[model samples]
Target: MGYQFETEKVVDFILKNSVKKVLIQLPEGLKPYGVGLAKEIEEKAGVTAYVSADPCYGACDLPIQEAEILNVDLIIHYGHSEILKEAQKRIKILYVEAKSNLDIGKVVEKSLPFLKEYRNIGLVATVQHVHKLEEAKKILEKNGKKVFIGSASGLVKYDGQVLGCDCSTAEKIKDKVEVFLYIGGGIFHPLGVFYTTKKPVITVDPYTKKILNIKEIGEKFLKRRNTIIAKFSQAKNVGVLVGLKFGQSNPQLAEKICMKYLKMIRKKELEIILTKLQPNPNPKILLEQYSTPPEIAANLLYMATYSFNDIVGKTVCDLGCGSGRLAIGAAYLGAKEVVGIDLDLAAIQTAKTNSRMVGVKVEWVVGDIEVLTGKFDTVIQNPPFGVKKHGADLKFLRKALSLANTVYSIHKSGEKNRRFIEKTVTKNLCGRITTMVETNLVIPYLFNFHKKPKYRVKVDIYRIVKK
Candidate 1:
């Protein structure tokens, strides 16, 4: 009677009915994961089984044709609460709720108070949890609440069909409701709640039978979710830091370089001082604010080579100078004063802490370089390589021209047109300049399922003094 299938009752019906063959109806959209469940049922029940090819409502509906084709006496359905009228009499439908990681009963109970507060609410969940969605919605309705179930078209059949999140369905109904109640096994089931509407979102975990903290789940969810705006922001002049040795992502390394550049910009804005932490095998590693990977000593050296610092003692500017590696290198080479800038407050703070290690006074600030103004005798920096996140190499060059007497910057060498960059800088810069091209030293590393070469670098040191 209820949405949940009682195992004993289903088994009793199957045994008593002299079921010679069994048919399993899985939602067309949920078939990929349902195939495994069907195999288990056949092995456990010792019965011949058939799976319906017919499209279904969350795997709840099956064609009467399947019963005739398989000649099965019983059919077990996965992930749907309703059966089509056509299949009702021909097939003995045993609707078993797909197991969820959350406790459904407790989730419903905990959400009663919230549901009662809103007269009308929108309900949504992922395909895996759709079986319990109707029942959950009904419970809210029974408590004097109105529920509108989102209409989600079944998954597409094409190979290229990108399975979009169910949130789009929720978005359609957002304006019609005062609040949204997401009933599913886990917070993942109701991600649509975050984007669909500004209405307060309540997530019920059917497996835990509890109402969870939506804010906590949302925060973690957003951290992993990639956005187009963020991508563009990172694409400006980002650098990704990958390890030269082993077990690292090449693309990730490129991103790290970008983060370092941004951190340098932030440091300038906040006027935070920077210090270099000890450079051991593992430098105090953390992803920059823009999601660049850890900056290793090898990366620092690569940046140094790319930075093209001329004879030391020239006042140098290190834009987005994370940990002051390039700045310190310039200082060590005899640059008079080294200035490092970054956008990350933490990196600037740590840079100040590590400045002692460099044994040099490097001025690090937390700010964006687009707004900073100053003059330096030379500018040495490793601008981000803008593969994953945007980089600010252009901004660095522009800033260098505006604030310094000469500029030396490192960037990805393999980008589409290396010559165009030289032209851009030459065109925008105030005076005569020289460019030196060099390939980024290739580093090999393992990450996830892929291994790749990391090298996209061209270092340019330009001299521009007021004519």
Candidate 2:
């Protein structure tokens, strides 16, 4: 009934393909329209249409095998752009971009105050708002602002479409603009600009007619990171943790050695690396466990424990602990007791292997977080973003809160979501946010189902103290 799907174009494409039967793959949000859409295609194009009800992470996850088994001639994948040209060649698939119906004028008006000062400003948006960028640009120009819109690259199929991984459009035009205007919904993609460049980044939310609290929020974000790095600088023994859950994405041996060597260059372990680069004079530990990136996890733990001093000789819990990054890092940093729990046997196995690899003592358990029932000094975790599941991350947060005096958790960043977390922590969990460290979280190429080799999202590290 609404403008989300362009059914006419879909029917036209099916008729042109001369396919007897076609398959339609919709994300969970769009599945309800399956019956109506199929009926429309069948009536208009005279081709039988079937809907794919499987879970889809992104455009990278095509239901090719299912379509092949069903013997469908074409696969109409909705809700994302193409991630790979190679997949297109191997399979008959068409990606349909589901444009939003949000009005552009209000969002443009709301953003003018931020844009009025910067005559030369760069503009970018996610796919939903890419179509309206030109309209936004016109409005800005009418008010004497010079707007620049860049083309999409890699997984971005249209002009100004920014994936979680790529924000090169803003970077490409960085030198030209005084500030960058990102037209999108959340604190997600706009953050890449903030992290990657010196320019001020502002996100114009079409839905809320609001902008991110960049000045107030960004400063708090950076100060926490500086504190964490400072804490690491003063430490006597540093642990470098690695956790790549989906695969053995440890890069090449030489690359791995380079990464290891740079983190204080443990001379005894190196074969011919002559230079020792010690950012800190601490004796570093290179521990391999499937955990969150050490850079993020260590900082998170720092925020939670209030410093390395607090973590030392303290009992800590790591939930959804993939590869024991947090637990081992804590153990290596001086935590007297560290327990790591995860549902994935492979991750637990990887964590145990990494414990032996790093020589840090930790209690590793393979089970759900609910199985444990002991009060802990602190809980450190990096849970799933739960963008798809709505409140999946909260479940982890609730479980950790029940068992710990303080909980350090990683979450996707946005004003609305942060408010929700704050409300939930205070009201539901009976905790208060002591420290907030927000930064861009890098997600490696988990699967080729994406266009880029890697991507990053704006994530928050919160330290919640139980009241």
Candidate 3:
């Protein structure tokens, strides 16, 4: 069955606004349908429609600039909410949520046994299935169970709908419900509920016809995190990595965690906020990278390089060197040979300029880290968390471990990650974590989809040493 694209509403909105030229933007998954969507809009509304080809990350990444560049009178955005209020005033937007058509009745039917235990259940779904949640709600209500779908509040405008960053809908009704019923697909959204509320979750995946009880998953997560916490009890000379990616950097929270750890752990006299751009804890210079914060980066660096032959005269490599922050920092710290690698040409160019501005000498290369091969005394990197590309971080870990005896890297903090990171590092790289630190990363709102000034991300910095 085809997904529901309410394009007629798009025409109504365009005609109502009396717009002529329209700019249409779609997310990566919905881009395949953009051409057809644009053609239909133009034919019905009699407006000139141009589809934005540039990648769209979320609703936050609206094509307002593109609309202005094309001089379009209106924009038809698909697959996300209106993230920026001010931008909507300047550029007229018609948001077309391409909701899915998968029937939740069958899945709800299959979930009867698991859900029978709960008297009341709080229901939530991602934007894709928000429209169809009513069907599932009806089935649940008709049975003995009482259903509670949270009303629209805060950043999210839809009742019971959740964005990746905003899950208030579920959080709001968590106490009222006996169990959480995620009326959508996948473990991701449901896991968020389990993490937030520590409640048993019945994940009704219509596509897979699998009703998953996420209690075991939550227990596994808790067990792993408990272990990591125990290890952190011993960390002395800690580095808190500070990243600058608009969604990943957080200095204020990093400081709090660092201070908290200092109070809890036995002190070794060295605590630094290691950043790729700035080593200091100055939040003003928190240029965005996707890895750990500066202090955490330094912690990882210190952990990886402390026992090393030399840091001032050592070789260091930073994979996925966004804007050359890590590479420049390594050079400034007196590393004799420092190399930074990234696939993004623009980021590499920016890194070069940053290096020049800082008066630092570092070799910058534009290519996949996998293509290059060389030995370094230490390797430090903030690779992608693999949220989009599964095991993307593992690729960097394997490469970094191959090139150096010691590696310092950052990853999203979670119980599932503990076992995975330990198992993967030991099996693939023949390495184990000699040191680790957990801290909150502040992710500022860069795109329209982000309503708050920033979001908090829990991340872990690890120093892996060869066995």
Candidate 4:
């Protein structure tokens, strides 16, 4: 047999523990021998043996609940080593790592020619070939190559052992080794090693007597993955499946997914509400009276409400509020009071009509930012980027800082402009920058100077707090 099932050790464990009943679990490849092992346990150990027909993926996927239902005293998990140290305290589990007994000398010799160009070689193997790593290392050393084996960490029980989800063994010795030689059956382990280390990998399959270089395979896998992600993002509705297995239970991850889905729903509803509002009929070119995009306004309000907790039951003022998109969003997000101030009378009238249409109360004032006076808890604004008018954004920032304790302001994003804004807020305005999020602002073709149907300008939302 190429693999050792270790029937004697299983009998020894059952007898030593005085186990009266036991459950046998094995991987798909080793499942056919499960019945034979169950019979052997009954004959030698004189105990009741039950074999689980369900597929076992790893030691982590133990049939603890099934064993409990059967009232078995112990569980015999084969083909992998221990991963869940906490689960062992709940039940008695004997992990029998069904080690492969195949000689890897011929395969290692086959990989020698491929590794001839490299002097340093990193040796790694799966759990089945972990015990044979030293034997393979000696062969590589005799061929004028220095071999390095990584120390075991986390779920890996032995040095140079690699799991499908973990490649720390390869990562630990990545810098020291020029190339890696993996002795395993499949391409999964070797592909993980190549991606983790980004080093040339030569896989020696002892069963197939084949040697493969996995660089091209890894590249192809990445291309396929990217294509899948691109197609998946275009999906309108998505369903999430949560695993409830002993080792696969992740309540925190599941909760995050649910929260993310709910947030998307809320944003979509808010965007629809904002789109139905009245836009400014007469927009002045010098004031840059471009109405805020409904999607972008919804995102900004959501961030303020959920992420920063600054919107609900707080006094909010939208400076340079063109057609009142930001101010209306703040009110929709449950602000205690909202104020919209704009120099244009037509924009202010549009804002008042829009607020009444949405059934939200907002105090719309037709005035300049410099004339605005009272204190507020939060102020959100999408001021002009000082493109047509110079230093226009600074004027709004200076006035907003004077009126509110916290301000959410949007500005054009660039390295030089960002540095200037940071310096001005900290030094001149006597305020501190709390958060700066980069997002895109869509500019539709509203004016004659506009060249495209729409332009996506990179912008940053600066969350400034008073010192």
Question: 1-467 in candidate 2: lDDT tens per residue?
Answer: 43378888887777787778988988665678878888988998898899887876567667777887899888888877777666666567877777877887877778788766679978888777788888888888888988887677766777667766677777778888888888877776677677766678888987777876365466466556655654553354655555332222344654775565366423222211111111111211221121365566655554444343447688889988876767777776668899999777767777787777767898999897889998888888887666555666888999988988877888879999899999999899898776676777666555435588767778887777787
Best by lDDT: 4
Residues 1-467, model 1: lDDT tens digits: 22233445555666787776877766544466556555655665556766666666443235455577667787777665442444556667776654454436556768877666678887766544555666776677778888786665444221111123335566767788887776555554455466446466787765456675475566455533422222223232444445442112266667777666654433222122222242222222232122122232223323323333443556778787766656665565456777888776766776676667656787888888775676777666655545545444666677777887665555555445456565666566554333343433333332333345543324332233332
Model 4: C-alpha RMSD to truth?
12.4
Instruction: Give the poorly placed runs of model 3, Cα more than 4 Å off.
Output: 16-20, 53-57, 214-467
The window of 10 residues in a row where model 2 has the poorest summed lDDT is 271-280
Over the stretch 155-204, how does candidate 3's per-residue lDDT look in tens digits?
79789987767778888888899898887666766877787776788888
In the order shown, the candidates' Cα RMSDs to the true structure are 19.6, 19.0, 20.0, 12.4
Model 1: residues >4 Å from true position, as ranges? Answer: 1-311, 389-391, 430-432, 442-467
Point out where model 2 deviates above 4 Å.
1-4, 27-35, 46-57, 69-71, 152-155, 214-467
Q: For candidate 4, lDDT tens digit of each residue in 7-101?
A: 89889988999999999888887888889888988999999999999988777788878988999999899888889988887789998888999
Q: Of the pair 1 and 3, which is ahead by TM-score?
A: 3
> What would the TM-score be for candidate 3 when compared with the true structure?
0.49
Deviation (Å) of 39 in candidate 4: 2.1
Residue 458 CA error for candidate 3 (Å)? 26
Clashing pairs in 2: 60-449, 165-455, 243-291, 290-322, 290-323
